[model samples]
Target: MAFNTSGFNPVIHSSTGGGSTCISGNVIVSINTPGTKLLYEAPQDQVAVTESFVELFQINSTFGADAAAGGSSVISGEYSIFVKLCFPNDPSGLDKIKTVQLLTHGATLDYTYWDISPNYSYIDVASAADYATLSYDQLGVGNSDHPDPIQTVQATSQVAVVHELVALLRNGKLGGYHFDNVVGVGHSAGSMLTQAITHSTRGTSTP
Candidate 1:
């Protein structure tokens, strides 16, 4: 992705989490239902799971094939994610990075959505304000790993990855670029994802 960092370090991080959800297009509607708490957990060591998407898909859909089963969507296995960061052009010149805007893009789009500088460049504007910026692809999109659509990559899984990144940022583990005032910015469906992150996390996120 084209970056505005005249002179700075850019950091990329990968996160893995799985055995999360297995949803088809129909189960998507239940996302907003009340009392819908989902499972989302990851290892701190960053070790990815070895199961394949195809295998997980078969198992999740084969619920009726077993005595205790019926067709299902709750998924299993390790989920991999990728995210990129852009620091201010001159870190020394800026005050201890005040605001960090975490960018989450919508469907069919990669992390490049926020970097389209010729248009409304979120990165350029934030960088001009000395804000550290992070833009990432959802787990199943962009540079992140691709898994079975029915076995993983649901809204909960997507939000789970965001939470993981927040922990990394707060702890100063993501490429050494740390900021307590992290903000989430998203577009379209990503806006929904950012809203999810904000509700689940203590920090601020703008949809």
Candidate 2:
């Protein structure tokens, strides 16, 4: 149903052409979840944040942002997210555009994990199933801004960023293509993040 692509390119676009769809670029998003953002703007403060990150991981308190701040703080950053849209190479693939599957990868990995190689690709599978697909780099990962990983890059803020991306998908901002439905599909921590986004956007948000 969707076969559109344009500028906003940051990562590589397919050289093969026409069998699939892809749009990528740097997107700046502001997430308000309460944490420290000041450290990233300074040198020594950045080191302190890194040290704190190590300590938190050592103690399994990576979710300690809310506890440390006793509340929420604004965590905003410029992120490089790619919406690799899969349109079926076949004519019937057009109907796949009606519903989109948003893909997110786990920690120690990025979006490309889903499309490991030509031998196996989730995006290709979704396309063949008549389901449009979406995959992006999680905020603070890959080409995204590394905002104080211990504080600003915690669960709350990351989930909020996903919500923002959902909104964009619904609004047809990534490319000229838009879908009537969207489903969040993730792996490990990425899956957990999607669950949080689903719970939080129950009121009035789409996708």
Candidate 3:
């Protein structure tokens, strides 16, 4: 069952009710094996040291999803993983106190924190790039000009990409795209987006 990789929608997100509500948007997924492998290496402490952190409060309300899925397979079925890094707006530092809660199928998951150092350091490629350049815009609707808003776009795109990657793994089309197992890893805004992805639906639907 070879899946057609073409015609897939980009993942994106949107804001509703003055930041109180957020709907999923278009999402885009990229595959980076080297980076993904480095993220999961060795002792938990080692992984923490190697990986940088993103500050959610400092990040803007709008964000793009450019997640990368990669890994090698062991035996059990196939494994696919995606990583999202988010930086939120927190000039007052009050937002840091704000914690994001994750829910899957309407149940609350445990609250987790990322290893954020005093001097925040996370590489963001989109910062340099123009938001207009992205496939999705803020509408939460679809368009070639702008797929949807950044947040929804990222979430939806991540879901779509993960779906495709997992489909590939299940069918054994992805040779090295395998792993012992798979799980969602996110920090700050990325964590929020992961929560959205975990519960989002396809084709212009909001979750």
Best by TM-score: 2
Query: On residues 1-207, what C-alpha lDDT tens digit does candidate 1 reach at each position?
Result: 222321123432211111111011100111221122222233234333223334336735642233123333444445556555665555464448756778888887987687663335666666666777767777767667776543366676777667666665665665544577778888999898888778875555422
Give Cα-based local distance difference scores for all models: 0.55, 0.65, 0.28
Model 2, span 140-195: residue lDDT tens: 68877665665566777777777777776677776655677789998998888788
Clashes of each: 7, 4, 42
Ranking by lDDT: 2, 1, 3
Cα-based TM-score, every candidate: 0.60, 0.73, 0.24
**What CA RMSD would you report for each candidate?**
13.4, 4.8, 20.4
CA displacement after TM-score superposition, residue 194 of candidate 3 (Å)? 1.8
lDDT of 2 at 186: 88
Off by over 4 Å in 2: 1-3, 10-12, 15-19, 35-71, 76-82
Off by over 4 Å in 1: 1-77, 118-120, 202-207
